[model samples]
Target: MKRFPAAAALLAAVLLLAGCSASGSSNDAGSSVSNPGTGAVTGDGTTKDSGVVGAPQAGDAAGSVTSGSAAGSTSEVATGQRDVIMTGSMSITAKDPIKATQDAVTITEQAGGRIDSRTENPATENQQASATLTLRIPSGALDRTVTDLKKLGTVNFVSLNASDITQQTQDLDARITALKTSVDRLLTLMQQATTTTDLIAIEGTLSQRQADLESLQSQRNFLSDQVDFSTITLSLYSTGTVAPGAPGDFWTAIGAGWAALVGALGAALVGIGYALPWIALVGVLALIVILIVRMSRRKGKAA
Candidate 1:
């Protein structure tokens, strides 16, 4: 009876030990998974925590973060991703530039683009009708957009430019990441800080870092937009101006020459007619003076 009681107590102890081991394993696994792989998110739904903590002193964090940032930036430069900004300008000639402009607007809209600005000039006696548009088109459809714009009129000039900003973007990203880490460390220090002087200094630094982060993020956003959309300045003009080596018939030239000659002769005749009255007045005065001189001579002879 004594042996049986002892065996039963041993079995109970073994079962309790096994259960405790399983529960501990499960708890540890849950904790590891619940923290998230990236970091902690807050009210703004942004990951603010940099997963860096437990440093002995916060003063040296900035320098360490800068060094790490430099290394990360270098790595980013070597990465395979490419970011480019596309810009272009084109000149097209059409019969009616105003109508072409509308077509261009429609095509751009269909291609998921928008006009940033538009200008139109009505045809004057001295100037041709024209329109200028600044368009923002998706980068993926840049070629297609350009082709569609060409269909609106005869393309006179087309220029496309691309700039690579991958390195700059990567550097900015690395700097932002390092700054976030430094800021996190500063916040932790602020909580553990005991002296008011240290707290004030830390807060001032944190504010500066946050400002810089915000500025960098803005730059990143602008760069991202540039990458997503390409800018194109489209110029549409009526085909009023003739290009060099344009086809011309000899009859047209002869007609122009005949018109010019007729105009020149007409101008000469008008000038002669205007001077006729002045010439007649001088002639009449001469005749009267001659008569008076002759009468005086005759009177002298008689005397």
Candidate 2:
């Protein structure tokens, strides 16, 4: 009877010990999972979880970090508000380039636009007067502005380029919104950060999210500016001045060939003019040498 009782007590102790060991292991696993800063966000804006971290814990407010510029692909812009950027270039020959440039500036300013840059070269002895003006005209008034500019001079060449960026705009807006949400969540977690390690981890993530948000905001602003303001590059020159890159016809080809022939003749004349002095000097030197040799031979024959 004594041996039976002792054996029962020993078996009960062993069972309790096993249960305690199991419980300790479970607690250890839970604590390890609760720790942060295992896998951080990579440079390309992807999240990598390190160790066995799962979703937001019981008291934690942050759920998961979202990537920058990778959110919301299905978003759409409003109808009729599609973002389109317009850029155009034109070449014109006018009676006067300076006056045309001034008129162009006035037209752009009147249409609620401005000049981005202007370059003017007064007619020199060797070159005709020319002006180049880069104007930013409001998108709504671009067509009218172009028409008005055409009146300033005779249009030689004109071209317009348009790019539709509505999808890109919507995508950027969505990314900004997502980044904002992520930052807000991180902020909340930062406030609740209980350990130094957790605080550091949250701070790093918050910084990254904030940086991404700012960058996206800047991009959105630039894109909006491009959509609102259409760019036009106007080139003006004197009426008699040849427009650069105007297509050539048969007559033009003949004129170019004639000019090339004239230029070659002129170059040959200049080269001959340079060589004439050297040729005279060599002829004079040869004549003196021949006279001295003849005189020496006569003296030898007489002796």
Model number with the top lDDT: 1
lDDT of 1 by residue, 177-293 (tens): 654664675577567544455456556656765776788689989999999999999999899665333336788768867987999999999999999999999999999999999
Q: How big is the RMSD of model 1?
A: 22.1
Error of 1 at 195 (Å): 1.8
Model 2, runs deviating above 4 Å: 1-78, 241-303
TM-score of each model, paired residue for residue: 0.57, 0.57
lDDT (0 to 1) per candidate: 0.68, 0.66
- For candidate 1, the per-residue lDDT at 234 reads 96
Give lDDT: candidate 2, residue 120: 98
